[model samples]
Target chain A: MKSIRGLLFTALLTGLIAAVALTGMSVYLRVLHELDVVFDYQLKEVAYAATMAHPDQLLLPLPSDSASYEREARLAVQIWKGDQLVYASNPKRPIPKQRQGLTTLYLDDRQPVMGWRVYTLYSKDKMIQVSQPLEARREVGIGMAWRSVRPLIVAAGFLVVLVLVSVSYGLRGLKRVASDISSRSATSLDPIEEAGLPREVVPLVHRINDLLNHLGHAFDAQHRFIADAAHELRTPLAVIQLQAQFLERNTDEKERAEAHRQLKGGVRRASHMVGQLLALARLEPEMGGSADEHLSLDDEAGEVVFDLKPLAEANGVNLALDTDTAWMIGDPEALRALIYNLVDNAIRYTPAGGTVAVTVRPSGVNALLQVTDTGPGIPPAERERVFERFYRLPGTSAGGSGLGLAIVKSALDKLNGTIALSAGEHGNGLKVTVSLPRAGEEPTEAPESG
Target chain B: MRLLLVEDDRMFGEALQQNLRLDGFTVDWVQTAEDAEVALSTAEYAVMLLDLGLPAKSGFDLLSEIRAQNNPQPIIVITARDARRDRIRGLDYGADDYQVKPFDSDELAARIRAVARRSVGRFSSLLAHGPVTMRHDTHEVTCHGKPVTLTAKEFAILAALMEKPGAILSQASLEDRLYGWGDEVASNAVEVHIHNLRKKLGKEFIRTVRGIGYKIGDNL
Candidate 1:
């Protein structure tokens, strides 16, 4: 992992090093230039002194500071009279004679350096040259530059240390956040603490808290759903218990057989309740499984009818389905579940010899599927409430789970469909009309929960 | 005892009715608060089993209405709503007891007996008269320290008379203890049950006034 603190500290230290190196090089160059002026003056002064002593020729004395210059570099002097070498001091390597001005010379071929800076003076047919090595000046320049830049390097080092400390302090918020999150249990979806957070990190925390809010809502809904399912199953369970007791109480063969049948029915009801609950739960969180499938609603409806034909027959309800090319885009399994619940509710509510007809056709560029039952229709005041989970109509004696309409609504919402409930054609039963935009036409907007 | 069971779920109501009937309770099961109101106005009951989640009208409102009218029949709320607030609300609205659903039938029967006993100012489950003692919980009847064999209907008739020793019990009221709303009752059914009770517990065990109802044979 790339740490913010490490990255910042390294960057600051590199900048300090580069700056310090540039300062040192410029100081070295400036010192070398200044030394050239001072050394050239000394060379001129020495040349004049040599010229002043030139009348003595071969017995001329050196300059008063010549001893010190010799210790540092080999200081040499020469005099030329009428272009002939007249006087020489330490003459093994002579200073090259030049036109009367200062010049650098390579006195020997054995050395790699520019050997000397020589000053030449011409007076009254005699030339005097005073010279020194360039090596000594370079060493002094380096010492002066080092002395000047040492404190700057120390200050830069201190700055780098200070930067590292502040960088780590600035990053403390992120560390606190990581530790805070890691210490919490997975079930706690509370918002991250934002107190004392850096400004740069506040937005990120806000977005995370928003996500946590959504997760909390989803979990609450799941919990409520589970509780409601358990609560609803109890009614069927209570009936099963009673039927079992009734089975134990009856002595006659026929009565026992009847009780046994009722007991089986109760078990079947509870099992159906469980199946519907699983379907509802799966569909509750973000469009259960695959939500996009190109299929015909009429075809799915036919499959649902085929599946529920046995249940309808058992209830003595005459089931009918009229199909057409009412195509739509939806999850095939969800559509099947939606159709099954509607048909099952109709069959359960309709009395014996009653008819439940499902018709599919296109209505106004939209596919419309209708389930009409010859049973008691919902009162207009209670029509809106029938879609609530676990809401049953008053005085209706069917052993329905009260989740049928709710499941249909859930699936319809996912498919971007609309449902309308009204009285059937004869005005004595319920007609549930569901309309969805066909697959080929202009698409609908994204689904929103009802 | 006669009980009025108000529940919206049909199968649950039927199953509970069957079981309570086997427990020697004449159960009048209704699926709506409106039907319950009608049943309450027409006949009195020993106890009422109410469910809170009724369609069109909730049982909570029905309970408040029942209490407002000062109907003093013992009410036991049997519902799937197990939340504490709901339980408190049901009891506060004058229910004799609150029972969560999927409960044991035997426990429900025992509660019914206890509430009925409490309502009638009787602390004990046994109804005693002269030489006979009847245990409603166990359905046991004894006379002179010896157990007596009696059918459920015979036991019910004897219990009704012994419940209030000197009080007269109308034939119709006694029939309510033996039959539910749909049970077919012969015209001479009460007479036949009384004759058989007399034969088993001695001919003078039950006494009848010529123009009124019957009472127990002897005073306490």
Candidate 2:
């Protein structure tokens, strides 16, 4: 994997190297130009020195050929008195008289070479000239430029090492966090420790820790739900097993007939529990957030009441619906589950000849649904606890999986709605009120609806 | 045997009561702990089947109450709570046995019989006196090595008498053992059953104590 430390180190190193190279070249050219100017000045000084000398002294040639070979090859001084050569540093070759000023000229026609930087000045009847080979000046200029750039090359090497070390040090915390995460077990959702972290990485660590906290809660809830579901399923299965055993042992036709009936009843209860469990699982928050369409709360309530009317009649509970056109945005199946559970719970808890009434209508910009039943209402303390999964009111003889209100609560959560349970009229019954946001309404009404 | 069943689920409780009745047990089923407590105080049960979850009062509270009152009725806990802690708590609270729900009916019946046997200080399902032998599980009785069929009521009465051989049992006590709370019995039902049992088993198998009740003679 490409590491952040490596990327930073490489980028800094490349930038430094480019900067060093650019500065090195510019410094070399500047040093070379300065060196040329200094050399020309020295040449002019040499001509002036010669011009200051006596005329007899200017006419003298070199003392010996061997001693003058190296010096004469690089520097040639010559003097002329009215077109006559009076002094020459190399007597074997005649010096050319050039204009009286600094100038450049090639020395040999057969072997071409950049010849000289010559300085000539006139003194009375004499011309004093000083010249140096262009090659020699170029060599000196390059040597001074190298001296200036050598230190920069050494500093560039040092900078590369420094960048690598500091980048690694700055990124150690990130590596530690990565390893800590990789070493954890799959079931571990503990928050990552954030101590001693760099400020650059603090926000990332905080986000990860938050995610872990949420995951831990989700996992815990899932485990509890599975355990409760299994526990609930065991009772009816035991009943079925006991009934099966009764059928196996009983020989009397009358006794066998009763056992058969009970066995069927056990199966039915188990099947119903299974169905409710599936509905609850499907309504979980994680499974929600799919596309929702505009649905009429009144129409949904009417359908639920129509379907449960036969059940209400069988139990001798009066069921009624009072509703108007109330539209909402929600999943149809989830809304059905919500309505079904509310009405079912009411009918089951209400006594024979009791009343269960449902109402749905638009109040302001919110769709309000109310279910009032002349049944024993939940106590103030138990109203909140009833939404817990598989939690049944103690001493209640109702035959349910205890998932009805829990399912209702989950559905309401999916619909972005709120539910409140309070005492009904005269404090003799339970009243459940649910409010959902109206579709195609201004968001200004949402806060009030909630 | 007469058993008390305390459970909150109406359908499961009714089915279990019916199944227990078919297994030759007269079961009185109550949907709440309050009713169970009332039944326990008012009547005698051979065993009590308790469920942990109830409408108002938990079965655990009822079990504790029964124990605190020094009631010696054997109780078998039948519940949906199968956790180890719940099992330990139920047994530690003085239940004779513990069974998780979805349990085999045969296993539960056998456990009930075992607990009842321990309570009565008897270890066998067979109750034998003279030439008659009855197997509780099969509800089969044989006289002089020949199988004989008896009505459920007659069988119940004979089993009650044979439970304590040579001990006089009043008609009321025998009727309690032969029927549940809602069953209606004729005034001479026990007498008619004893008469039929005597005719079928043999004339001298059971003896009637004048104005008291009936018994099986030990010397027969």
Per-model TM-score, in order, reads: 0.83, 0.79
Could you tell me the lDDT of residue A257 within candidate 2? 91
Compose the digit string of candidate 1's lDDT tens values, residues A1-450: 997777877888788888888888899899889989988887888788777663665365454435764456456788888879887776775666798798888866888586789888998888888777898888777878889889998998888778888778878998999999999999999999999999999999999999999999989987888889889998999899889988997787998998999999999999989988888876674545666877888888898899889989998999999998777888777788788888888888888999999999988779999999998888999999999998877666577788888898888877788989999987889999988888773356889989
* Residue lDDT tens for model 2, A1-450: 997767877887788778877776787778768867887887777678778877666566533325633343366678888888777875654557889788887878775565677888998878887777877766665666677778977887888788878778878888899999999999999888899889999899999999999999999999999988998898878778777877887788987897788789778888989999999999988776545877889988999999999999999999999998888888888899999999999999999999999999898879999999999999999999999888888767566888999999999988888999999889989999999988763234444553
Candidate 2 residue runs with Cα over 4 Å from true position? A29-41, A44-96, A101-116, A121-126, A133-142, A243-265, A440-450, B33-46, B55-73, B83-96, B118-136, B139-220
- The first chain of model 2 has a TM-score of 0.85
| Candidate with the greatest TM-score versus the true structure | 1
DockQ of each model against the real complex? 0.66, 0.52
B1-220, model 1: which lDDT tens digit per residue? Answer: 8899999888898889878877888899998899999998888888999999888788999999989988787999999988899899899999999989898888899999999999989999888777788899999988887998888889878877888888999888888777878789998899998998887778777999777889887743
Task: Provide interface RMSD per model, one decimal.
Answer: 1.2, 2.2
As a whole number from 0 to 100, the lDDT of residue A329 in candidate 1 is 82
